[model samples]
Target: MQPDQVSIATQGLLKGRRVLVTGGARGLGLEFARHAGRAGAAVVIADILANELHAAAEDLRAEGIQAQSVVFDQSSPESITDCVVQAAQWLGGLDGLVNNAAITNSGGKALNELDIDVWDKVMAVNVRGTWLMSRACWPALKASGRGSIVNLASDTSLWGAQNLLAYVASKGAVIAMSRSMAREMGVDNITVNAVAPGLTLVEATEYVPKHRHELYEGQRAIQRQQVPDDVSGVVTFLLSDLSRFVTGQVMAVNGGFVMH
Candidate 1:
């Protein structure tokens, strides 16, 4: 279904905003783009997946939303710089960013069993990539006068999920980095915050074991598997003026699974 074909009851919270989401061609990133578009923002979806990226953007355009897609490697500085510039050009301006691209399940092994190559690759993409994207978008964000950033973190970073040491560490770093970035960006009137979602059932997590799913579901006070929409709404709010005073915080959208 097209975007307009769906309910648009966001009250135009993000109207007149231009937002970009990394890894936005699939999974949770795509959901963020969907919500942003419905909230009345012109959105740009960037990802390394060429075909899916184009299709995702077309999906938005079919709904009469101003949307575009770009393919670039989050791990490559040159690619990130060029992509941000291209995204700003596509939207005619930039107001918000969703750093939702990151590597997880890098071997899915214990820290002692993890390969150095896998660890490095995860850090490069998950940690270093977020840094690069944020830096590249700094100028455009400042220009918006109502700049906002929502970094994707994980509940594992807060409550320690086993066998995913690298992902947990990377997200922990994201949480830390967001606090520092908020302190700095507040001078530019840009709010920087991280959304640490629990075990959300997105397309990327379709391979998750049934028992593992049950475990997460059972742990949640809501007693159900979390979905992308569960987190997307919070991200949309952060990107909108409704959350202007909220920054440097890690809002967990885990259905009370890992309350902090």
Candidate 2:
């Protein structure tokens, strides 16, 4: 959708809604929060980075946006539950959740070279974290009657990156979990979906090998790397009434890098 069309559709569409975004301190998560706030939703930014999360929240508040921040470690089950409860209380209720917290093992290590500890850590945050957050927010979301959950996935899972086995597997799990949750929650009027983003220029992806990035560049039909805003718009749409009929789908935001 074009920017103008999105603006028209979401003009105050989320007015009075409350949203929670995990890992929302920076990068794409920040972008998602900004857009949702601009659309008139009260946003709760949660992240493991206390300082960064607070700074982001202050910045949003500076813009006169209704925002709050909470420190949350996605890899820890206890932290996930606590964060969800805190956010729900802060926001007075919950209407949506963006499971954007994730970590890629340092360097694109193949499965054989990947350390077991790193593998477990990745799964704990990326896969298990998503499940825990969603489950924890189930009751609050059900209360909203118009609940939506957007899980952050990746193009690596779709095309199978050569050396990011652990990250790829986790993202693949996110897609599957999202589908199942969508099916299970559909009867309750809750919508669950995943956003599989292509390689985007962010602090996290800066460490990716140049050659690997070039490979992604070549695959993108648009011939350009993705930006945070590119992915944020779709997330906002999915959380809005515009996509009320959409669920259990993986919306790829990779500039056509992984078309399906």
Candidate 3:
């Protein structure tokens, strides 16, 4: 099954693969699911938003793509566990995981004005949630014999954004954890990597100010706004045979906003 919007040559790029994407009902996650499906992977998108999740899945199905959506709560261990198990069952097995689910809160809140509850909530969803999802999918991933994991970080963490200390700190932890995750998962032929994307205009990012978009565009060498599609292809590559030998790397998809 494939989507009519975009076509891909399905010559084992992602053939016979099964992948699970968290926070995938819309925005970046939705794009990933669509692109991956086109590439020949059986894609499952999990998100906390039930109505949106079902709608996204139906859209894919309408395009002849076999897609599934599960209700996911990143901060809940039981939710993560059950979601992974069900996704694996639905797909027959697991081959890849995209930890794309994260909460950015309101972008501009300085530490002095930031609430403790907000900070803790950000950490719980971004940092701890990724770890929990990876752990829960470990066995099924190991069984794939060539499993891939993609954790979504952000450019804010890479080049430090003002008024987002908690989020930046959490993603920094994601970068730090990627190395260890790769080290451990390598033993099972599962590659672990993190992707840091610039501000992209998606449903989840509707709260971003217009000035911020202009600032990002002005700062980037590409001189354009980053879209959800810009970030999906790289992720599909990371989850394909192409990146079999690649791991422990953080690819910044910010159009040169944060170059390492």
Candidate 4:
């Protein structure tokens, strides 16, 4: 049973596409890379965690998928530029970019008691990193002529959450930036969109207090928590030709947690 023999609805949806997924070493990013690779896309798993990225790539390759790993630091503008260049060179040009790298910390205090340093770090990684990555990949995306960009946003961006002001604010910026990018790139045939996940149980959310976790659980009409697989499908759709007519939209995969 070879990978090419696997039967799937979106089989070979990206047969000749080259995809670069930032922060793809683990968790949701890893899931995205796996799905895209399985769908016959040549995936470049870029992450700051070099060891893990290499391992993930190897695992994919073992499954007969065209996958590679590159060391990348999304938070640094220079690093992001270098990464995009290397990735484009390695993949022979990019068709899709996943801006999924972000930093999140539990700011236990309210606005008055918040640490300025933590706030800066959060914004730097989430907002600034996303912007830099998108800009660096702009030329390659334009060249692809059917390019797509998906930014990982959070449900908090749509609605405010207490004590997590920095994360919320950064995601809000992601949504806005994505919309603007979509408009700017539409003429180039590059679609930009955002995926907002509501309280997904990923490594990034481990620090969230139990009460806060419960809050999300209670809000979900489905009465179930979200998993990485829950969000990966929508991401794949947005990156595939199925979404060619879709742009500047924020797709939520929160299991009925957030209607918006």
After superposition, the stretches of candidate 2 with alpha carbons farther than 4 Å from their true spots are 1-9
Per-residue alpha-carbon lDDT of model 4 for 165-194, expressed as tens digits?
A: 888899999999999999998999999999
Error of 1 at 183 (Å): 0.3
**Relative to the true structure, how large is the alpha-carbon lDDT of every model?**
0.90, 0.89, 0.90, 0.87
Model 2, 1-260: lDDT tens per residue? 23344545566878888999999999889878988888889999999889989999999898778999999899888998899899999998999999999998835677789999998999999999999999999999999999999999998899888788889999999999999999999988999999999989888788888988898888789988778878888999888888898999999888888896
TM-score of each: 0.96, 0.95, 0.96, 0.94
Q: 1-260, model 1: which lDDT tens digit per residue?
A: 54442225574888899999999998999889988888889999999999999999998888777899999999899999999999999898899999999878563587789988888988999999999999999999999999999999999899988888888899999999999999999999999999999888888887667888899899889998798878888898899898999999999889999997
Residue-wise lDDT of candidate 3 within 207-237, one digit each (tens)?
A: 8789889999999999999988778878988
RMSD in order of candidates:
1.6, 2.4, 1.9, 2.4
Better of 3 and 4 by TM-score: 3
Q: Candidate 1: list runs displaced more than 4 Å.
A: 2-7
Per-residue lDDT for 71 in model 1? 97
Q: Positional deviation of 41 in candidate 4, in angstroms?
A: 0.4
- Model 1 clash pairs? none
Error of 2 at 227 (Å): 0.3
Best by TM-score: 1
Clashes of 1: 0
